[model samples]
Target: MGNVQLSLALSGYDHTRDLVEGRVATPGIDLVAIQLSIEEIFYRVAKFRDFDVAEFSFAKYVAMKDQDVNDITAIPVFPSRAFRQSSIYIRAGSPLRSPEDLREKRVGVPEWAQTASVWTRSWLHHEVGVRIQEIDWVQAGVSSPGRQEKVPLKIPVGVNYSSAPDRSLTEMLLDGTLDAVLSAHPPEPFKRGTGEIVQLFGDGGREEEAAYYQTTGLYPLMHVVTIKQDVLDAHPWVAGNLLAAFDRSKQNSLDRLADLNASRFPVPWLRDHLKDVERLFGGDPFPYGVEANRATVGKFLQFSYEQGVAARQLEVDDLFAPQTLSAYTL
Candidate 1:
């Protein structure tokens, strides 16, 4: 029989580029990789199940899984990993000097259940000594108006959350209506290097490094690759096949980046930065599979449960396809 055909939706990340470009192939399956923006992929996949396989928010996926919804299952292929220490933004000279200053202040988020916001809140609660209930939370789009929460949230008691469909978080922060904003994407003004907005953690690279040293040695997982449950049920072997292909694709990307003879990226000292990453995170900074990412996965589950995003704490096995829990050794 010919290979099974499946549609895969994902972001245009360097690690996923090889798969999209056909440098990597999924055995026993023909992957139709469609590159998309993070917002489009997550919204379509989570809300509508639009693709056979897609990248998903770690927080939203766990929340859906906890709700007993079985529309999809994920592999351990994390296409995106980012440290959220730099995600918190504030007015250029707001009184909010530290994460602690956010308590009892109005802080806006694109969505309460946003994966980056979840990690930011986890840091504030555990590291910065600010409980979520202490803040008056506002939800809105980062730059544009009228963005809504993609998943139903079980907001903990005493937490005040209001939706501002008419105003964007950037506008609110600029107008002094919001003390700060925790967003996955920077506000438009900030992206353009406008001095009006600035990151909460000044010197983001240094702070993120310190945060990494304090907690798990992870940049934090933002998105994971998921397969529709019906697709998995019909072609059970597709799970492992996709996992192996993704792992290989990521490795190929890394090999390309590590080649010193020619710079793979536009940045000067790209090779040196790569070496530093390898020194800090080892050979495969972004390893796939449940075991390789156990600490990060476990920590995120803990944060999700503690923050009331997930109905209950989900185990690694509970979230990933069983076949992807372990890899066959040589």
Candidate 2:
């Protein structure tokens, strides 16, 4: 038999490697690596025609809307360490101290085309009373369609960091090139730096909003992995098997929570945040049992309609393959 093909999109999270490694150890699985941001996930879902299984972050789902794909079985939302809550970082020396203080201020963001940006901007408008149109937006990252692709509209005032290494933005934040940096959540290193958070862009306030976004009319966060429908049909069991393995791996990671805390990633400071590291174990990381997946599907469909991202309202029941929900729930 040939290898079991599996593709995953990732945020460069620490637990992501653990999940992929578990799949590789399985009897029949060939994991394909695609490092993607949440914005890219939407494009891949819209354009790609081949993929067996896709792992996604909750934010990515919120951005793309799950109904964009028809054969998703069970999508488990993993806790991204960076996106635990909404917060914006500004240089310690900057005069602006609140979200309301950011009128026409040049703000740095990884991707303006993403749902997190939308959610963040929405919060700034409704909660903070900051008009998004007035904010000088800086879009960072390589391959950002907003700037690099250049649609008819002028690109937002932002630097595309797709070409720069991951750590470059942190440097920019420190040097004062960026007035404030907005991410899903600031990494521990960013927090350790002299930068101060201006405002958390959500209704629940800083402490409670992260969990609230997961359940409310909030869109799924950006996730990177996806495969085309044809590949899944050809593979038959690959999609289900991968989700099962990831669910097992997620469980294993939680059971050995201490080990995960000690495990290292590219960033040492990120690994040192024990309290944050331990948070993934707090709730059902794999919240999408059949019912939850259905609920997410409904939410994504509603998001698409309300956001004008999609033309037709797709049913959550028809989105994933038959029995995918039942089989992957556990």
Candidate 3:
């Protein structure tokens, strides 16, 4: 029989290029990989389930799962993960020097259920002692107007939250309507290098972010690869096949990054940074599988419920497909 043809969609990333380009092939499947902006992929999947497999926001995935929406099941192939401390932005010389100073201050988020904002709020609530309810939370587009939350939220009582669909978060922060902004993407003024806005921490919050990693051992998972439940139900082995292929694709990128012999990436000091990352993050900075990411997975769910991103608290075992959770013994 011919290989099962599966349509897959995800953002363009170095790790996923191998799979998209057919350098890494799913054992029993042929992937018609479609590369789109992460937002576009999410919109299609949420509204239409447009592809058989696609990248999903970890926050949205769990939110739907917690509500018993099982049309799609995620595998352990995390395509996007990043330290979110650098995502917090404030006007230059703001009085809010620390996260604790955010108490009672207005903070803008692109969306309440945004994966990056979820992680950033976790840090603020858990690490900085600023309970989420203490701050005034405003939702809007980061760079454009009218961005809206992808999922419904069961927000807690006493939490000050509102929406500004006509104005962007970047504009509010610049115009002083908001004290700060938390975003996965940098604000327009920051990108423009106009000196009007700056990250809450200097140098992408590297010193503090490294400290956060050391203390929490959390790299902050932002995205996951998901397949339709019906697809998985029909071909159980497809889960393992796709997982293995994604793992290989990621490793290919890692190999290229670590190979300083050629300029595989245009990043300056790439060789020096590779050595440093290897030393700090070990060989697999981006490890796949549920067992490898248990802490991060569990932690995200804990706060996902606390913050109302998840309708209910989710168990660690409840998320990924069972086939990808374990493998046959050697």
Candidate 4:
């Protein structure tokens, strides 16, 4: 039988580079990789089901699943994972001193149901004793003037979320209109090293590392690879094939990063940094499959339900294609 051809939309990350470059092949499928920004990929896939397979937001995916939008099903391949402690930004000289200080303050976010924002909110509510209803939430782009929530959200009662289509989060934060901004992408002013805005966790790297060690044992997930349900129905083998290929691609990337003889990245002390990461997250930090990520997935589902992004609490098994949930041993 001829190989099935499929279109895949994903970000240009090192882990996915092998799949994009044809170094790793899906068993009997011909993949057409279309690299795009995370926002574009998520928006297109969530709204239009544009690609046969795509990297999608975990929060949005759960929200869709909760709403019974089952056009797409996911594999256990997570393309993006991050610790979101650093995502929280506060203006300089603000009265707010800690995560607990966010109570009753205006906080802007790129989207109400963004994966990064979800994790950040979870950290605040769970670790810092700040409830969602206590913060006045604003939704807007981090850099640009207008950005809208792509998915419908059943916002919890007493959660004041407003849209500022005319203003960016950066502008609002700088002008004291917003006390904080929770976003995956740092606001433009913050990225430029302007003293106007700073991360709420002053020593973000150290704080994030400590938070990971103290709370959840793994870094929080941001995106997962999803296959169109129709594609899986027509080609049941595609699920296993895609999962295997993604696993191989990620291993290849990890191998490159762990090569100490030659520096894979241009950053100074990359080898040492890699050692630190390995020490913290183990040899295979970014693991795939439901069994490997159960804790993180379970916590995220709990957060989504609590935050009203997911109408009902979901299990990890329910989120992934059944065939991709487990693999047979040789």
Candidate 5:
């Protein structure tokens, strides 16, 4: 047959130069634009979680893991505050001070959120000894179809609020309608979006306030990629090419970020944030070249299994396109 057309998808923040180059077996190749929202792609891919598919994360690949997948690179990194630096927001002048004060109180959250809401709930219920079931959950933006179907786990007795959740959450918090709001960062509605609200505490409980509730450990917010093995088997060249191309692009992007930042994407918070993106690329600029792929895959697979997502333990080799690695040696 003629050259195969492979499809790839990523978040808006991600740079795609490497991905496109990695997949190009020759100067010219077939095309299949599979562009979609990251959430939409993830939701679609999650449907096939039951299948025995092979997958690799460009982020994990570039970070220098032990194993090899196919071509993938320039993986995206979000604002750290959106993931690690999470917090609970209450009225500025309210008596509800810490996570402990939120017990049995109504809490507002972005409706049907997968990672942020799920992590927050799991942290509160499992780690903090808080009976999250007892608290009232106001799911904001329930009417938005995109947001509605994205629920990771069921909301235990949450009220599906349809109005603009940002406004609702802020109003509720201020008017005492909501006892708390669990969000990656404080809601922006209060300040008219100029500045974000400050976090109450760091990842765990406050060092000084020993009485407050906290988490047992830091949880991963997002990092999973899956691809079908059938496609790779059909087109052996695609996988390796994609991986190598992505590695080069990630390296180039990292090195030239300062130059690219001013014109392409200007933001003080985002500047130099991707210095660690190379960590995933490992020693070489190609995916699966070094042992970094194996290390990352092993770690995340174990994490996924522990999180009760995967049914059984999958060996590192079981998830990657092995043929792709041989091509990388050249």
Candidate 6:
């Protein structure tokens, strides 16, 4: 039989470069990689089922499974992961001292079920001692107005929640209507360095994020690679093939990222930064697999459930394709 030609929509991520660029090929598969913004890919895949395989929001993936939509099955490959503490921004010169100070203050979220918001709130409640219900949560776009929750939510009772349909989160924050904004992207004012918004964790939150990792051991995950259930059913071998190819692809990027001799990526002090990352992660900066990330997965799902991002707490076993979950022997 010829290779399974499939449409794969994903954000342009360095880690998945090899797979997308044909350097690392998935066995028995002819992947047509569609590069787009993460938001666009996610919305198209979730709303329209536009691709055979796609990068999907981790929160939305879990929520889909929780709600029993069951159209897509994931592999253990996480294409996007980041420490989100730096995403929380407060108006410059605000009296808010720390995340704990967010208690009872209005906080804006791009979406209640946004994966970044989930991880940020988890860190706030679990590490910073700020409970979810103590903060008044407003849903709005970061730069534009009228952003809606892409995934339906069963908002937990007693959680102060509302919406700002006509204004952006950064707008509300600047207007004093919101004390802070927890967003995946820095507010436009913050990006422009207008002295209007500042991250609660300072500069890039590297120090604060390092502390968060020390406490939680979680380099929080944001996106997962998913294949349509119909595609998987028709080609049961696709899951394992994609998983192996993705790992190789990640290694390819890591090799380039850690290159000390020549500049593969355009980052100054790349070697120094790589050494720091290696030291922090104990040499395994980004391991891709269900078992390798069990604790992180559990913590994320637990937070997802508590925050109503997912309908219920989902197990690691329940989240991925069975073929990718464990090793098989001849």
TM-score for each candidate, following the candidate numbering: 0.96, 0.58, 0.97, 0.96, 0.53, 0.96
Query: How big is the positional error of residue 211 in model 5, measured in Å on the Cα after superposition?
Result: 20
Q: Any idea what lDDT model 6 has? A: 0.89
> Which 10 residues in a row give candidate 2 its minimum summed lDDT?
145-154
Model 5 ranges with Cα > 4 A deviation: 17-36, 43-82, 87-96, 99-113, 118-178, 183-223, 228-230, 258-330
Q: Name the Cα RMSD for model 1.
A: 1.4
In candidate 6, the residue pairs with backbone N, CA or C atoms under 3 Å apart (3 or more residues apart, or in different chains) clash, namely none
Model 6 lDDT, residue 28, Cα: 99
Better of 1 and 3 by lDDT: 3
lDDT of each: 0.87, 0.50, 0.91, 0.89, 0.45, 0.89
Off by over 4 Å in 1: none
Q: How much is 180 displaced in model 2, in angstroms?
A: 4.0
User: What value of lDDT does candidate 2 attain over all alpha carbons?
Assistant: 0.50
Ranking by lDDT: 3, 6, 4, 1, 2, 5
Measured on C-alpha atoms, candidate 5 has an lDDT of 0.45
Model 2 lDDT tens row, 1-330:
888666666545445567665542544677776666644554555456233455543333433443354444434433342332356766555776556777767676665444455456655655556756666665554212232311112232342223233434445665676666666645345456533433334342445464555435343444433445666667656656555655566666545444554543344555345456346335443444346545645654554433333445656654444435565224
Q: Look at candidate 2 and tell me the lDDT of residue 13.
A: 47
For 1-330, candidate 1 gives per-residue lDDT tens digits of: 899999989888787788877888877888788988899999998778999999999888989998988889999999998888888899998777777788999999999889999988987887778999999999999999999998888888888999999999999999999999999999998899978999887786465655564566766889998999999898988999888888888888888887888878878888878777777776677888888889888988999988789878888889989888777778
Please tell me which model should have the higher lDDT, number 3 or number 5: 3
Ranking by TM-score: 3, 6, 1, 4, 2, 5
Angstrom error at residue 91, model 6: 1.4
